[model samples]
Target chain A: MGQEHILKSHDNELARLTDEIVRMGEIAIEQLREAMVALQRRDATSAESVIARDVDIDELERVVSEDVVQLALHGPMARDLREILAALRIASAIERVGDYAANVAKRSVALGFTPPPPQARGLGPLAEIAIEMLEQVLQAYRDRDADVAAAVRARDAELDALYTALFRELLTYMAEDPRMISSSIHLLFVAKNIERIGDHATNIAENIWYVVHGEAPRQERTKLDRTSGG
Target chain B: MGQEHILKSHDNELARLTDEIVRMGEIAIEQLREAMVALQRRDATSAESVIARDVDIDELERVVSEDVVQLALHGPMARDLREILAALRIASAIERVGDYAANVAKRSVALGFTPPPPQARGLGPLAEIAIEMLEQVLQAYRDRDADVAAAVRARDAELDALYTALFRELLTYMAEDPRMISSSIHLLFVAKNIERIGDHATNIAENIWYVVHGEAPRQERTKLDRTSGG
Candidate 1:
């Protein structure tokens, strides 16, 4: 093959891989949205559907891995090498995001067993922030916008603060009414799952920065979730 | 350099990467052991120590990534490519295992505030099983022993069952005494963290199988943790 042909094919392969990752990210975001809706509506069927669709994201992640191996066979150097590594890491992070979304859906199903507590509404804002972060990070990845990625990384503290507030609120609610303990416990995990989704989004942001700059971000963001310190 | 020299250097690099990963795994295991002790003894000092040392594992993971990039620059084909990919993945899994260990330690510190519950004793067996799985999986990775890796994968069900039992126990304990709610919630997270460590160990086991076989394990293992099902 001519040199131009080789370069063209490599570009095409890279584009395809990038597209696959974006699609995976989109599916993960959709899953999170559906999970939140299910949680709010007490729709076990929709929640179950979200759970079933998680495998699709997992399969896409597997496809991305294979694409990465194919690209690696070309023996990419320096910048290309960094992009490949970032792609692998980002895909894995997105898969975890999908898993966390599925966990939320699973807990939503579990939440269906009892009367929905008023505190269940608190999860909405947390999920909203996480979903927004996931969307922004995916765009940063697609555009290779390090600045936007950094902005997304900085926004995680917002999610953390919201999660912490809901955690304390739920604890208080559970304490006041012992009967709410079982469902509130499930809500607690669901909230934790959403908080972790924010972390995965941050991970994707950091990977994007690494891909663009060939280095890690200069400083780690301050963690605001003080629940573990209590 | 001659072909033989190149091959020898490659072998040496691979050996170095393997050794580094093993050392990282050992540090993570020790962290978990110390974290569990801190929880049992309510030693916030030891727990803080475990949290501080988590950075060492993160540093080792960064080194592993550099080693992987160097190895990839050599343009290894097929089996060597699979090994490089598996090494990157295994190192990431070990890093997460370390993070979970650190999380367990953090919650142990949080648990120190309240009087130790008798139910705290329940976490011991769960941690024991997870620690054993991690040790066996690391051995399997070092030896390239697919059979041992498969065995470790199978053993995760036992850990899951134990986690479920403990989850119910903690909930019951908290429900019985409202005063214990705060500490029990921390223990719940601690238990969840340990359970996640088991999953990471299983992830390592699966990666070892991939390295040996060049494919995922044929059949997905059955998940035994039914807590999400309510």
Candidate 2:
């Protein structure tokens, strides 16, 4: 085999890996959005579908790991190595998104028959915001636009503020409406999990920015609060 | 350098990695157990101390990663290489345990001045069991004992059983006494987070067994409930 032939095949491999991860990311984002819709409408069928499809996302994640190992052993040319490593990491984030999607679906079913609590109202806006962020973050990631990715991460502060207010308000609701407490607490957890998914999405955006620009984003972004009771 | 120097240094590096991860895991277990005590006693200072120490665990995690990359690049001798990778994965789990310790402390403060909830009785036993599992699982990991690790994971089923019964009792208490709602929910999240720490410990034990045997352990004694919300 001549040098140019080997080089051409390696470039083709890079293009394939990049395309595959983007496809996987799109599926994850779509499932996350759909999972919320299922919850809002009490659509168990759609929720079940999301749960079933998560295994496919898991399989895709496994394949990406295999590809990375193969690339390392076969030895990517200098220009292609960075792209492969970046895609591998992004695939992991996408896989996590799929897990969260499955989680949301599970919660939707568990709480579906329970009467809606006041805290459920808070989750509506939070979900809307996270879905929007997931959409833009995926686009920014696919474009490798560090500037746009950074902007998406900055948007997380809004979710944090919303979650904080909701936490306090829910605490008050639990105190006032004892009958509604169990369902309300479940809603609190579901909303918190969705917010965490947003955090994970922001983490991926930062990782993409880092992959493009050679440094992780700042440490000052709304980190996990140390006092849950406070 | 002679083959002997190369081999000796490789062995020393592997030992260092293992020792560092073991220390990290032990510290995290201490932090977790202490945070639970702080919560039970309503001792905010102890909780604050646990939160303050989390940064050290975070720093040690970074050092562990760098060591893995160095060993990979420098070509650690064959036996040492496998041990280093196993230690690397275990170190990641240990760092997460540290995060959960901080989480427990934060929940302690969030719980505030409310009289302890009735459902919290379950947490006492769960804590005792988790403390035992943490010690046993870490021992299994360090000693590379598959049987001990398998038994440790088997105990997670009991944790789950305790959690389910605790959650139901908490719900019942809230239904009967609306005033206890907020504190009950706080304890619920704390209980859930501690159970998750047990899950991570089980993961480390499984990895240790894999490192020794070159294959996944046979199916665990039992799996977490897929039907119920975790």
Candidate 3:
């Protein structure tokens, strides 16, 4: 093949790789949303399904890695190479997010079998913040919008704050009724899994910024006292 | 330059990258050990230093990325390319391990200021398990030993089991005495952070297996009922 034809084919291949990653990102987001739904409704069947679907995300990550191998073999330019690396990073982050979702799903199954405490009320909103962060960060990847990614990164604190409130509330519940201890501990881990999902979304947003700018953003990541209250 | 000379230079660059990564891994392991010691002694000064040193790990990650870009720009063959990619993956995982250590350190500071609960006894062994995993995984990376890596991966379950035991112990403490509730929760998070550090070490072990085998390990990662009692 001529040089021009080969270059054009590389471009097409990169586009295909991008499409696959975006599809994988969508699946991960669906998994997060579905896990939250399962938790809210205490639906074990739905949570089980979400947990099962993580295999699909894991498979898609393998596919993306294979594509990365193919692209690197073709000797892409520096800009394209960095973009590929960023895609790989983002894919790994999204897969971890899927794992966190499955963790939440597993927690939902556990919660379904047991009686929940009254303080379980705040969990839905805590999960919503995480899901929304996942949504925004995935959108940031699709649009290559660093500003949107920054916005998603900043909003992680909201999840932290909500988690803090839930932490305090759950401790009080456990203290008030010793019988609530086991279930409250389970609920605490579920809250922690959701909070970690938010952290993964921020990781993805940082990858997005890296993809767009070819380096990490200059701002230091905001660190909050996540273990204390939120 | 002759083709042979260029190939040799590439090998040198790759070796340099690998050495840097090993150094970074050593620093991360030290951080984990220091954090655990600080927690055990309730030494706020030592914990503060661990948190402060995470910046060094972050800087090392940036250095690794720059080296990856430089190596990739040279258009090395597929084997060399995959090795470069694995180095990047391992570097990121170690940085995250450092972050987990810093998190443990932060928890140490919190636990130090607060009165301790008696159940805090279990945390020492839990952190020890996590530190052992980190040490073993880094050795796996240095040796490029897939067997060692797989062994490290399997040992994560031990940490999980310890964490589950700790979780139950702390819950019982909180249930019996309301006064122990606050510090118990902090201890709970410290245990969780140590468990997470073990997870990161497993991640690095997987990366090592990938780098050695040129694909993910064939074994499905061992899963245990981590949330329940041992």
Best by DockQ: 1
> Model 3: runs farther than 4 Å from truth?
A1-4, A224-226, B228-230
> In terms of lDDT, which candidate is stronger, 1 or 3?
1
Tens-digit lDDT track for model 3 on A17-133?
777887887898789889878877888889999999999998898778757766766646657756766787888888888888888788878878676556778988988888888
- The alpha-carbon lDDT assigned to residue B26 of candidate 1 equals 92
Of candidates 2 and 1, the better by lDDT: 1
The local lDDT score (0 to 100) that residue A128 gets in candidate 3 is 81
DockQ of model 1 vs. true complex: 0.64
Instruction: Compute DockQ for each candidate against the true complex.
Output: 0.64, 0.40, 0.40
Q: Mind giving the per-residue lDDT tens digits that candidate 1 earns over B89-127? A: 899999998999999889988878778878888999999
Query: Which portions of model 2 show Cα errors greater than 4 Å?
Result: A1-18, A69-91, A115-119, A212-215, A223-229, B1-8, B76-88, B115-119, B213-215, B218-230
Q: What is the lDDT of residue A64 in candidate 2?
A: 72
Q: Distance (Å) between predicted and true CA of A68, model 3? A: 2.4
Q: What is the model-wide C-alpha lDDT for candidate 2?
A: 0.74
- Measured by lDDT, the strongest candidate is 1
Q: Taking the tens digit of each residue's C-alpha lDDT, what string does model 1 give over A1-230?
A: 99778888888888888999998999999999998899888999999999999998888887788678668767465477788778989999999999998998888888886777788888888888999999999999999999999999999999999999999999998899888898899999999999999999999999999988988999879799998976
Q: Clashing residue pairs in candidate 3, if any? A: A164-A229, A164-A230
lDDT of 2 at A208: 75
